[model samples]
Target: MWHTVVGAVGLVMGLLPHVLHHIGLLAGTAFVAGSGGTALFGALGLLASVPMLIRLYRRFGSWVAPAVGLLVFAAMFSLSAFVIGPAISGAEGDVTTPSPAPAVDHTDHPGH
Candidate 1:
């Protein structure tokens, strides 16, 4: 039971950086927005969850537990990227109305 809880916590921690980035929280950070900072943070989350994964593996004596972990990670990633992120960033309402385009000047100016 505790192993399941730990795994869930680890998944959330692991995906936090991505979620923050999606919500525009990491926009101003050069490292997090540009380089591989998000990936680094994600890897760290996975590393932190290593103990939980190990425990699951030992308890189940099979690879199924680890595979389930991977599936959960993927599901959470998708959920944040597609649903939660867009909703939080207001991207979902982007299609509601389009802004009017700026008028262009057709007059031609001659320079000597």
Candidate 2:
């Protein structure tokens, strides 16, 4: 009973960030844009969910709870990344335009 409730809560919590990001309420960080940083961020999320996973494990007394948790995370991530995000923000996602290049200085040039 408690496990089911925890799993449902976990699913909703996991989906929250995606919903926020898709709706432009959340901003992306440069660190998370890099490959290594992305991995680190994922690891951090996993670590953060450890307590919930533990509770699920204790209740189920098997690997099923943890597996379900992982699946829920993946499903939420994919649903947002592929479907909701594109629908809300378009196919380009939350891309920002690049800033203009700085003007070149001509004072130091002898020809100038």
Estimate the Cα RMSD of every predicted model relative to the unseen true structure. 7.7, 9.1
Model 2: per-residue Cα lDDT over 1-112, one tens digit each: 9788868767775675445445443244343333443455456567767887888999999989899998897677667556775687455544668999999999999987
lDDT string, candidate 1, 3-99, tens digits: 7887788688767765766655446354554226646665665677578688889999998998898778667755755678678766664357778
Cα misplacement distance, residue 66 of candidate 1 (Å):
1.1
Q: Show where candidate 2 strays beyond 4 Å.
A: 1-29, 32-41, 92-112
Candidate 2, residue 9: Cα displacement in angstroms equals 14
> lDDT of candidate 1 vs native?
0.68
Model 2 lDDT on a 0 to 1 scale: 0.66
Q: Best candidate per TM-score, number?
A: 1
Clashes of each: 0, 0
Which regions in candidate 1 have their CA more than 4 angstroms from the true location? 1-28, 34-37, 91-100, 103-112
